[model samples]
Target: MSQNAAAATAGPVSPDDVAGLRAAVTGPVLDPADAAYAAECATYNLAQPTAPAVVVGATSAEDVAHAVTFATRHGLAVAVKNAGHQVVPSVGESSLLITTTRLTGVEVDESARTLRVGAGVRWHEALAAAAKAGLAPLAGSTPGVGVVGYTLGGGLSPLLGRAHGYAADHVRWIEVVTADGVIRTVTPDDEPELFWALLGGKGNFGVVTRIEFTAVELTAFYGGGLWFPGEDMAEVLEVWRTWAPALPETASTSFAVQRLPQDDALPAPLRGAFVLHVRFSHLGDAAEAEELLAPLRAAGTPVLDSIAPRPVPDIGAIHVDPVDPLPYVETGFGLREFSVETLAALVEAVGPGSDCPLVTVEVRALGGALDREPGTPNAVPSRGLPYVTFAFGVAAPPDLPFMDEHLAKYAAALSPWTDPRNVVNFIAPDEAVSEAEVRRLYGAERYHRLAAAKRRWDPDNVFRRNHNIRPSSAPAGD
Candidate 1:
């Protein structure tokens, strides 16, 4: 028998009983010898990668359940990773890391317009499946993120969320493994309160194994980016702020300030300089889409323009989020309105005059379809914001102080229109944005109700990671 097997047979499982549990798991139970162990644990931001005691390569839902049960039995903390894109380093040291990179499954129901996806499934997989059935889900700008993780955090898709609300709003059901090692299927119809809390409440309640959500009848869209020189960003942004909210449900847009490396990978005009990109996703006829976007496109000398009808899967090319891993910090706030004054302030903060070599500053317009309340049970409560602003700083060195200063200036500039509350998913792991901020973003009533439900289902606080939902103090024990 292996050392792990011998340890198991010895009996009396202690806090040092991981070797024994490793003996039981069928897949490769890693302990640093695995070459990809370090790389696998490295997240998208690439700043931190916790050294877990054992990395469990889960092959199926049963495998996931086994890993969870084993961790609980052995008194070992556990973390679930899919695509390892967690902006926050939730997975920590000596933990049993359940790597669900193998569960690739998708079942589409055309009549119901829903797709049941495995926890490991990526956006590209779902996008292709939906497109085949003349349907689409609210997917993020990039198609590389895991479906379950993103949806559970309330996915904001590029396909005009204003008309569809959030990706979480469409979820019909979820299969999860609780801390006590029970696999349960939850839906609004079944566990109504649990269902409501898990949608936007993050991974505090349980480990979501599968996701089922609605898809729209969209195969292609009038989507692309129009680039302008740095000098003209001011005029272009002003036009975007004035026109974006007035846009119909068929139109979704954002203004972006980007500094691209002079490389062949980037389009010719966007290379080697600070540029303004007005990204668009329109569902209307080509002629009408052009007519609506003419004012802003006409505002400056066009360096590059690629707005045209394209399949939805290729939408990543527009935002062009870095595919390669690098250290980065993301901080954002929701704006009540992106007025002309607000636009000017933002331009001054991160535009041409700014010293930051930031990857991008984006202002996503969010009123049309996104503002409407969903009839479903979920937790993306910030509906009043006309725009959501984000700053992604990539050039900051390890242990850099300049990053803090840049973010401070950017925050100060937009302070007038900014909401005190911000999304939990966007905050850096190191920064303390405060629970009060989260409550403000989620609202007192919803936060309170979510806390209550969290207590009922996860009173022991076993599943605590991601944007954690703390149990209420009323019930100390179940």
Candidate 2:
């Protein structure tokens, strides 16, 4: 090993080492002792906190490359954080953290209907920019989520996902700083293999600086949520299971049983109550949207119905995801089919009177364009899976007796219908994903291919702080 590498392994990073990092990059380098360190390290899911030896507030692709090069020379792990929505607990004090929040930039090509967004740019920013051009990017439910990270995880958007597929599939180019300290502009034509790997590969290979992706020529959508009492969860789910599959490509739908806290911010009906929220987004006329949703509306009376024609910029309002960061435990699994048995199991697990401590249990219907393969193949796995079940529990100080037990029980109950695989995006922050689970998530063939690519792009495994795809020749380490 080099002298720097030996020194890095010998003991904790000294102030001089941090000073060297600061000198190497034209960005702020923060040590743990710095006053701003804690705020810079704060993540969206507070449950997976990280304490890196140094945090680099990256302002440009060059800064990212400098940080990666520094980490490589010092034999330190490198981790990238934008919005810090998806957490990987492996990034600890031994690693070098690069925060991309300073790299917020957005450029739109109206004629091509494309958007180029910086790593730190959130969905709402991109949406607003695209909306000016009468276009819409495939953004997920939450507007606060970082565009780059979300796209890397095969972003499942609310509005046009069933019609357009994942946001990763729409990507045209990616600007990344690889482990070798090289700034690469990845596309199908330029470094095709790396391009494919980076799409759904997460941050294992490099820190992405910017992404250029296709946007839809859409200005508005008729979509929103309908809230029913907790008592009607089973019936609502049954109706949704049937209704969602029958819906056309222009529509995407999901249902969630939300046990909302009694907060003043919440609507009067939803505050302090267990309610079932049915979210629907249609890319067609308002009248058609209403007509298509008639059956679900007829099934029961909703205490709150906000379904109406809305501008595309306001799409995030449909899901009503929390805007502020909070401590939460999330777990999810893909299902081959939402069978009658599976529906029953779901109701038993979190429906009324179950006393489930989970804040919300959601079932999203997947099919249509999401099932279809993209023109250019990428790393996104589990395309044909029909449904996904996700549950969120608040990470409160007073431990609930049923937290782990209920989660396991819920998974076991749906095991028969559940696919052994997982959608990478839905993987929880603190979830322990084993090698076997990785193989199950990505098929054996794809997993091996991803590993081969990892070997080529990040041979030393410097960027291992993610849903890692370990190089075939390298020993897997945390």
Candidate 3:
């Protein structure tokens, strides 16, 4: 073994050795003792905090490669963070965290109608940059989410997804630093399998430093969110269950049962309220969109309504996801279909008198382009799924028992419609961790192919932080 490898194996990395890493990289190499460590490791999801022995605040792709090289030499596992929206819980001291927040770059190719952004670029940033050129990327429900991570995990845009498919479907290329410390520009012609796995496989393949995707020609939309009293959930949802599925490819819809907080962040009408939020988006004339939305609108009284034609940048107005970190447990799974029975089940679980304890339970209608395949094939697992449900509850210590029980109950109640595979982005931190669970997520054939790619690109399983796809050569149970 080399000097560095032997030295690393003997014990924890010595101060002098860490110093060597700091000197090699063009970024801050922080340790727990460093005064800036805590701030550097903060996460958007307070429920799953990140704690790593070492953190590299990478400024560029070269810095990321250096950090990966440093971690591999020390036989340490690797984890990555950009916006820290979905941070993975660190295993222990043997892991190195690479924070890509410093690599904020956004470039719009007006002629080609494409967007290229650094890993740190959020959807809002991409949306703003693309708008200046009359194009748009498939940004998610929340504008604050990082573009790279969201697209890699098959980003589901609440406004445009049903019309244009997943964000992963439009990726033109990806710039990633693999476990071997190599910076590679992956494309369909040049690393097909790697490209396929990276798109829908989440973070299993490598740490993506930058990504580029074709943009849509959208400048505005005819939709926003509406909030109705919780008591009207059953009635509104009844109309939605049948109405949403029949929406044209130019339209998309979703609704959530929310027991909101009394925080100042929420609007006056929504603060400390129990309400049903109905979100809609249509790439069509305002009159036509309004005609399509008439049935659901007339079903119940809307306490807050903003469904109107707005600029594309206001796409986030459809969901209005929280802008601040809050302690919560999130889990989601796709549904084969949302039939009348499924609606009945949901009503039984969280309707008017159900006394559901969860803060949010959202069901988005999925069909149209979302149910179809992209031009080039990718590993996105949830294609063809008719609907997907995302549920989350607060995770305070005192609320653990009730929350856990209720969450399980909610999942069990919807099991009849549950498809084994899910949208990769919504898989919870504590979920799909086991090998069998991950296999079940991608299905046997797809997971095996993903495993083959994992074997080629990350045989040692260095990047096992997110919803890990183990290499086929590894022990089955791992």
lDDT top scorer: 3
lDDT of each: 0.73, 0.84, 0.86
lDDT of 2 by residue, 172-233 (tens): 99999998899999999989999998988888789999999999999999999999998997
Give residue 207's lDDT in candidate 2 (0 to 100).
Answer: 93
lDDT of 3 by residue, 1-478 (tens): 3333342454576789789989999989999899999888888877666778799999999999998888777877789887847667554588889988899989999999999899988888899999999887899989999999899999998778888899999998999999888999999999999999999998888999999899999898988888999988888888898899788999999999999988887889999999999999999999999899999888999999988888888888999888888877777898888888898899899877897889999998888888788998899999888888998888675666677678788899999989986898888888898899989989999999999998888877778877888886543321
Arranged by TM-score with the best first, the candidates are 2, 3, 1
Sequence-dependent TM-score of model 2: 0.96
- Local distance difference test, candidate 2: 0.84
Question: Model 1 segments beyond 4 Å from truth?
Answer: 1-16, 88-90, 396-400, 421-424, 431-433, 473-478
What TM-score would every model get versus the actual structure?
A: 0.91, 0.96, 0.96
Q: What ordering of candidates by lDDT runs from best to worst?
A: 3, 2, 1
